[model samples]
Target chain A: SAVISQKPSRDICQRGTSLTIQCQVDSQVTMMFWYRQQPGQSLTLIATANQGSEATYESGFVIDKFPISRPNLTFSTLTVSNMSPEDSSIYLCSVVSFGEAFFGQGTRLTVV
Target chain B: AQTVTQSQPEMSVQEAETVTLSCTYDTSESDYYLFWYKQPPSRQMILVIRQEAYKQQNATENRFSVNFQKAAKSFSLKISDSQLGDAAMYFCAYGGSGSARQLTFGSGTQLTVLP
Candidate 1:
């Protein structure tokens, strides 16, 4: 299992503003995933970040709205651009390796 | 594509009692894995138990055990002698065996242990 550190743990941003969440893994992993959980809702996959390549976004999510960057195997960033009130949710980053997946503490974003 | 389902949205158990959480998954891949994760209010996900598909024997960890029904695509978690520390959200997850390790998680069941 790998430990993941995510920051800013939480933030309150204006509707027009943007926020970038960073996730760093203790060890190298082949796949990293970003997920969003709306209040009292299930987790939804945003995208899959592969090191040194463009991230693969899930259906209903676009690269422009949630751009992802994986500079290396141990680091990835997810940027929520042109945010809106609907973007208010908890964003979690998870790393997958050796048949196991470990998640970060998660970033709680509130867009007002 | 795989989908995990947790029928109960919330459950309550008295301290020192046992409770079971039901989970069912729909997947075409035979070589997959099931997992149970606990998320406290702190929002950090912790692995509680996991069951490998190939193994016929169920997995047990100290006070937690899983009844895996491969044929029925069902996996249920049983927590024995529940404690206040077990009050949290439990999520059932499924993943494939190969390079794709992305886990499909069910809608979590919020467990509250009454003391």
Candidate 2:
């Protein structure tokens, strides 16, 4: 298992502002994923980020709205741009290690 | 594309009893993995169990076990002698073989363990 440190744990942002969530893995991992869990909903894949490359966003998600950066194997950041009430959700960072996926504590974002 | 489905939105079971959470997924890939993750109120995602699609035998970890049917594309989690700690949101996930094949999650089932 990999230890992931997700910053802020939570945040309260205005509708027009943006917030960046950082994910730091204890070990190097090639593929890291970002997910959005809306209130009372299942986790939806926002994007798949591979180190040293651009992220692949899901169908309903876009890079402009949810920008991802994978600077290295162990670090990645997801930015929620132009936040709205609908963008308020728990943002999670996940990594696949030893054929199993491990997640961060998650960032609970509240947009008002 | 892969989709995981969890029909039950919520379920309850008495303490020390047995409860089974149902999960079904659809995918075209032959090589993949299925997982059951428990998310407590703290929102820390915990991996409960995993079943490799190639393996016919079910996967078990202590009281948590999975009934995996490859042909039916069904995977279910059964918790025996359930405890209060087991109460949380359970999510079924699917992961295919390739790097481009991303992991998919089900809508989740909220399990309530009554003491």
Candidate 3:
């Protein structure tokens, strides 16, 4: 299984501030996914990012609000822009290979 | 489009007992993959088991096993001799074969294992 290192692990930011979460995989993967798991809620797909191209955001999610960057096969970043209290959630980065998927430990964000 | 459904929002089972979590999904693809992921209080996403739509035999790993019915589009997870560590939120996910193989997850079922 591939090991994913995600940071800052957690953060507390004031409303209207923005935060960027980074995910680093131990190995190279073509595509990486970003997901948001709200407090006591299920995981929602934010976007699918591919190396060297634009990311595809899911319905109800926008590139302006949740921008994703995949600079290379092993690194990707998701930025939550203009954060609000509602933006508080655990952000996860994941990759799938050979019918199995691996996820990062997740970044827990709290906006007040 | 694919949608995974987990009818039970929460469930409880006595330690060392057996419990099954139900899951059903809707998809048009003939070949795909179904997965059961466990998220504990630590919030790490752990893959419990996986079943291929093309395979008729169920998939199992230790005490965790899946009952997969391809025609009914049903996949269920059964944990035998459950332990306290089994308590967590369980999510059922679906992924179709493609370049953009993103997983569609269920709402999730919170399992409580009582000691």
Task: Tell me the tens digit of each residue's lDDT in model 2 across B1-115.
Answer: 7899999999999999999999999988899999999999899899999998999999999999999999998999999999999999999999876563557899999999999
Clash pairs of candidate 2?
A: none
Chain A only: TM-score per candidate = 0.97, 0.98, 0.98
Tens-digit per-residue lDDT, B18-110, candidate 3 = 999999999989989999999998899999999888889999999999999888999999999999999999999998876548799999999
lDDT of 1 by residue, B13-68 (tens): 99999999999999999898899999898988899999999999999999999999
Q: Write the per-residue lDDT of candidate 2 for residues A64-84, one digit (tens) a residue.
A: 999999999999999999999
lDDT, candidate 1, A1-112, per-residue tens: 7999999999999998899999999998888999998887778899999988899999999999999999998999999999999999999999877677899999999999
RMSD of 1: 0.8
Model 3 chain A — which ten-residue stretch has the worst lDDT? A94-103
What lDDT tens digits, residue by residue, belong to model 3 across residues A53-107? 9999999999999999999999999999999999999999999987678899999
DockQ each candidate and list the results: 0.74, 0.60, 0.68
**Native-structure RMSD, model 3:** 0.9
Model 1, residue B17: displacement in angstroms? 0.1
TM-score, cand. 2: 0.96
Which residues of candidate 3, in runs, are more than 4 Å off? B98-100
Q: Which portions of model 2 miss their true places by more than 4 Å? A: B98-101
Supply the global lDDT for candidate 3. Answer: 0.94
Q: Give the C-alpha miss distance for residue B3 in model 1, angstroms.
A: 1.2
